[model samples]
Target: MQTISAPRADARTPVETPAPLLHSIVLDWYRENARDLPWRTPEASPWAVMVSEFMLQQTPVKRVLPAYAAWLERWPTPARLAADAPGEAVRMWGRLGYPRRALRLHAAATAIVERHGGRVPDDHAELLALPGVGEYTAAAVASFAFKQRHAVLDTNVRRVFARAVTGVEYPANATTAAERRVATGLLPAADEVAAEWAVAVMELGALVCTARSPECGGCPLRAQCAWQRAGCPPHQGPARRGQSYEGTDRQVRGKLLAVLRAQHGPVPRGQLDVVWPDDIQRDRALDGLVADGLVEPLADGYFQLPQ
Candidate 1:
């Protein structure tokens, strides 16, 4: 147990988080209310967990469900995915929104096969070293898949903490060192407990303490929530912008990639032209895609997934 101290201004002292109340109430509520997500089950392999992490990024659970199953079915192992072309990975990605994640997951699988014998690394640092894996993803895979004790601060978890503990409507647009430090302090001392708490907090945020229209009356933490006690003030922080897809370069790229994903081999440039009408924007999107390594341009001007 940590020695409780009054608030300090020093960097060494982490800001106090609601420790026992957070740990117990959240865990118990999670056991009763948590959705039976497949990836969290005992049968899911570490690779399955890793793949789920990759597919879940910015994409909704409903959208990712079928893609995750099909992706794993085709390339069950990291080596299998690594052996295939990037185009195949992108193609398998379907309409997952961010096709780049598929490409990065492929790259990560390649790295895993090459460096770690196809096993998703259990160590946080090693996981972070893998392509497409960031601090949150690394910690998530390690703690959730490997049962390591780590603070998994995803968007949902951050929102939960912001409301329940920090008395804020939302966390900063970006994560901060202070936020991480507080998360670390909030972790249960027991490894297994800490691991469970990580997912529990995340599930609470996802299902209950959502970004908008939180079901506070139904929430177990409602009585203890600081934001509620503080009269639920509106967010005074910078505007969190929503992404737009219509007529943007991203939409053009998606259209272009759709043409290629439908084909097993290289497609002629003319096929891509019909996806988008404006020649200048379409060309820019294609050029950006090729430059980003998501699409490959052959000597004959045909396009395909990277070999």
Candidate 2:
């Protein structure tokens, strides 16, 4: 998929303020108000953190809580999940949406078992080499789970960096070298503190510097925030919009997957056909699913979640 190139940072991006002061404020705020997410708990394993990262992509914490709990309870380790059929992962994914993530995660588990002695590797390069892990996931697992001093740039952290330092209402559509420099420059000197700072900034963005309806009045960074100082200027880039799902191909795909997920084995074509009225759209969605390896076509005229 093509992505819009990120604009280079210019004079508008503010010079970062004192790092220690910035760290202290956000870290304190996080200590007081961070959500009691299961992934953040001391007892959470590396595999547990990796699972949470996968489930939390483009998905809210509220929706992920139950699924995360159920998933860990069922397959507590990479070896355990690696032993199961990939189809089982899709079934266990439930209605959290984005079923393809399930397949990638299952594949990652299998790789971990095969190459890392059933352990989720702490090394960023090894993490990135995993099936579903990308730059953000790699940085996230390294920082959050291993207490490494890497810049963990996710949506929330990017938003925080944009508004607080870049004097913008939003980050660019794509992650940029400028954004990485800003994130890296602000990292705390110590590895452990940098890890804590990464999560703290993310928590602040999630709870206070939110996408819509940000509670700036209560934000600890209000005094120094570039966007706030600039009167919270509106987004100057292309019109920002949320993804539409109703009546989209994604919706049709979800419905078809629902039928497959419910059954124990391959479903008849006739049974899958009833999920949508438009045969063209439904067939296209099913074909896309099969092409994506989220579904498998059997010798018989039937489909099922990939084995």
Candidate 3:
């Protein structure tokens, strides 16, 4: 029996080579098959892209679509959002979950206004300096909005790369520099257009090469996929921790925020109590909301969205 060794860190592997086949195949497929997400449209503004990215951090597209449109409609630009109270952003966030993202987005808008002259900065480092922007988001904004050459390595992209390059069903816990190198190696030569290719690859990962129940038959890269050649083995790594929504503080927090969102101003403790039966749990949830800067206490014993 013969055994195959994994590619070494220093080896001049085929995966490291600028495989035109991979880029052309993925980009060509993307041109015809990409989802008509509003943010991906050519007319999307930087502010719109930034908002979409932030809203999409944990929320799915189906949930984010209406909220994204409503958010931009209310606060069209960084200056507009920055001018409004943080409370308004919280209210606008609705039941999107992770309400602190709303506060951070508000802070980011203010920072963009004060530091970047009311425009989303094109520089990756400058964008990363914003409140909620991380490596993936910074690269996403730079590539999607600014049309720069950056490897946008999100979970989907990481999975795609792991399967395509290393024939793995899943990637490691966190992205490493090696992953970046592999992604960069696959990037197209033209910096201006490379961003599109990056987005196309990410779209493919999200829509086709999903974590569970991947539609391998319909995948565009089926012919060239390393995982397909390797017999499409099941992922055997440590299982990812599934999120618990029921009986958790997050659920209570969402319930509290939902009541506040429906109301105009301060909501009484009695009104909030109806959402959760447990008094201690409700109090803890409200306290967590306050700690997270998503809620504030009013003159009476009422709670309001943070100002």
Q: Write the per-residue lDDT of candidate 1 for residues 1-307, one digit (tens) a residue.
A: 4321233347595444356866788899999998888899999999999999999999889988999899989999999999998888988898897889998999999999999998888999999998899999999999999998999999999998788777789999889987888789888988889999999999999999999899999999887777876789899957889787788999999899888888988899989999989999999999999998989999877999777
Using lDDT as the measure, which candidate wins?
Answer: 2
Against the hidden reference, what TM-scores do the models get? 0.93, 0.94, 0.92
Better model by lDDT: candidate 1 vs candidate 2? 2
Model 1 / residue 33 / CA error / Å: 0.9
The worst-scoring run of ten residues by lDDT in candidate 3 lies at 1-10
Evaluate residue 214 in candidate 3 and report its C-alpha lDDT on the 0 to 100 scale.
88
Arrange candidates, best TM-score first. Answer: 2, 1, 3
Residue range with the least summed lDDT across 10 consecutive positions in model 2: 1-10
How are the candidates ranked when ordered by lDDT, highest leading?
2, 1, 3
lDDT of 2 by residue, 1-307 (tens): 1111123356575345577888888898888998999999999999999999999998999999999999999999999999999999999999998989999999999999999999999999999999989999999999999999999999999999899888899999889999998899889889999999999999998999999889999999998888887788898967767789998899999999999999998898999999899989998999999999889999778888888
Q: Write the per-residue lDDT of candidate 3 for residues 20-70, one digit (tens) a residue.
A: 766778889899998999998989999999999999998999999999999
How big is the positional error of residue 90 in model 1, measured in Å on the Cα after superposition? 0.8
Which regions of candidate 1 deviate over 4 angstroms?
1-18
